[model samples]
Target: MKKIVSKKDIAHLDQRFRANFINSIEGFKALNLVGTIHSNGGTNLAPFNSIFHIGANPPLIGMVSRPDTVDRHTLENIRSTGQFTLNHVNETIYRKAHQSAARYDTNVSEFKAVGLNEQFINGFSAPFVQESKLKMGLELREIKTVELNGTYIIIGEIIHIEMATNKISEDGFVDIQQLGTITVAGLDAYYKTSLLERLPYAKPLM
Candidate 1:
């Protein structure tokens, strides 16, 4: 039997329960560890499931950051340095990536705390996860605030991408599943994905 949850039902649900329900209801999401560096050279890493594609021509990407009710080191660092990195969470490093979300002191680098190695490349201002199979360095373009929720929509332009050459197909498609990239449902549940099939672009019947 199908169950119905109205707006009023959601409003009255327990806070944590409502959060889980709404987050998971949207289905699987891309999981990436955002990496930034503090002015004092301390590194910060935080796992975000909200990274999304904004455009392709200029290679834009978007990510959402929670409200600043408390200290959000990742957001703060990005604002200060105008640069950050998105590191794909793969089977070998998902556990350490998840641990990056834990609240830690501003001076403590999540990479060190979680036993992940920090990697800098080609003079990029931010660090990348050495264990990640795919990594992207981005420069902040703009930050839009949602009035209703006080969350931030961070838009960035892709500046650099590092991955295995074999992961890209001749047609320009990336085989993320083959790279062992993982996904997430809701706040804490992680999942691995497998490609069922690939379909060609749709067109009208002749």
Candidate 2:
């Protein structure tokens, strides 16, 4: 049976409930996942659910950063080094990734604390996580700030990409779901993924 949503249902709820409801409807199961911002100077900060790929040709990738009431280590590291790696979390580092979201002092390196092995290119000092099922190394491309909210969106050009050899198909598609990629639930919950169906692109009528 389908349950109908009526305005009266929300009207009776408290302000917090209403706000959370709106957030839940919009952002629930938002392909949310965690990634490590591998910074130069051997500093790696784990952050949750901030990954997005912007384009294909230039292979642009992006992530967002809100104001750090504490200290924004990821933002600062990227600004200084001009490079960062996005390491998608899997079953292995799930718990560690959540712990990284805490307001830790900038001096602490979450990478070491979390037991993530590091891989780095010689020219770039920022290290990439070897354990991630998928990872990308990006060079800083563009950054835009939302003036009203003071949040920043950082876009980078992908210079290198790495994936677990087993996850790629002979046809060249990355079977992320088959590889058991993780996703975010709400602010802190993590969920395993399952496939629903595949849809083809629409064709134009002659």
lDDT of 1 by residue, 1-206 (tens): 99999999999999889999999999899999999999889999999999899899899999899865222798899999999999999989988988888888878899999999999988788999989988999999999998888899999999899885565677999988878899999988989987889999999999
Ten residues in sequence with the least summed lDDT for candidate 1: 66-75
Please give the CA lDDT of all the candidate structures.
Answer: 0.90, 0.67
List model 2 lDDT by residue over 26-105, tens digit each.
Answer: 55242322233434344756664656768988888777877653225677777777878777777767787677666765
How well does model 1 score by local distance difference test?
Answer: 0.90
Superposing all C-alpha atoms, what RMSD in Å does each candidate have to the true structure?
1.4, 4.0
lDDT for position 178 in model 1 = 78
**Model 1 root mean square deviation, Cα atoms:** 1.4
TM-score of each: 0.96, 0.78
- True lDDT of residue 186, candidate 2: 53
Q: Any idea how many clashes model 1 has?
A: 0
lDDT of 2: 0.67
